[model samples]
Target: MKPKKKSLSDLGGIMYSTDPSFVYEEENEIPEQALPNQQQDLRVMLDKKNRGGKAVTLVTGFRGSDEALEKLGKMLKTKCGVGGAAKDGEVMIQGDFRDKVVDLLQKEGFKVKKSGG
Candidate 1:
């Protein structure tokens, strides 16, 4: 494959224009992390659609940073005594721990509901 072109952001520098009116200043600022919405409810369920008949506990409707999601996933995995992965704003636990996860999330101030059988 041919080498792809890089954008200004990929280059990591500010743009400059020949015109005196145009100027670019590089501002390195980290955005404030978003807090999870209390009004919004999270869903926990079991999914086995594409895993060759293996069930995975899925926690969705998480509205926060990936780090926060991973933290929650890690906590759940620890509590359930199992292993899993967290990514793409969703947490996946290796087994069926719907009730356990729901209880845990409720304790953590998350409005969680069991979805799907």
Candidate 2:
């Protein structure tokens, strides 16, 4: 099977007549002083979900990309010698690693706060 050919205007004319660099220029114009502090900006939560009769700990409230979360997750897992995954901006460790995670984030200069039971 093959897809049909369409012009730049086919997608609601978003791609056509729009200078791609326009957005980039606007984004790059923001000064560093305008950016929020990392310590006060991020939120950490522990969510428990019942999957297949097993409880899973979901650590969320990160304000970065998948790459950042993945890197942090890898480091945390390696440091703790455990298993986990970084998905959708959340880090899921196989066990209760809240304290360990907080410590690691603190060491990395992140302002972290534990929320929820």
Candidate 3:
């Protein structure tokens, strides 16, 4: 199934250019590189605000590409033996595993800190 175009901006912002010589230039974005594990300052916290009171362990402060983020998330999930998601530069584990997550990250060479209750 084809996806729907949400706005005029999706058409490259020059939908009605009359000039025959006009050419659409697509913007190329470069993904940010992942930092070394030792340089990563990650925070592990327990969050329960929007999940119907079910607490989740959220790891934030990752500065890396989505692929790297997903890989890290997968590793965390596998090691923690829990189901969760990794996206938007954050990794969410299904339950309250802040202490465990912090220890895991620290062992992996990341500077991890436990934040929040």
Off by over 4 Å in 3: 1-30
Backbone clashes in model 2, listed as residue pairs: none
Every candidate's lDDT: 0.81, 0.61, 0.87
For this target, which candidate reaches the highest lDDT against the unseen true structure? 3
CA RMSD per model (angstroms): 8.7, 9.4, 6.1
**TM-score leader:** 3
Candidate numbers sorted by lDDT from highest down: 3, 1, 2
- Against the true structure, what is each candidate's TM-score? 0.69, 0.58, 0.74
The per-residue C-alpha lDDT of model 3 at residue 5 equals: 55
In the range 37-117, model 1's lDDT, one tens digit per residue, is 565478999999999999999998887666777888899999999999988768999989899999999988889999998
Summing lDDT over every window of 10 consecutive residues in candidate 2, give the lowest-scoring window.
25-34
State the lDDT of candidate 2 residue by residue for 67-103, as single tens digits.
6668877987898788878876577777666787787
Question: What is the full ranking by TM-score, best candidate first?
Answer: 3, 1, 2
Q: Model 1: how far is 105 from its true place, Å?
A: 0.2
Q: After superposing candidate 1, which stretches have Cα over 4 Å from the reference? A: 1-33
Q: Give one clash count per candidate, in the order shown.
A: 0, 0, 0
Worst 10 residues of 3 by lDDT: 1-10
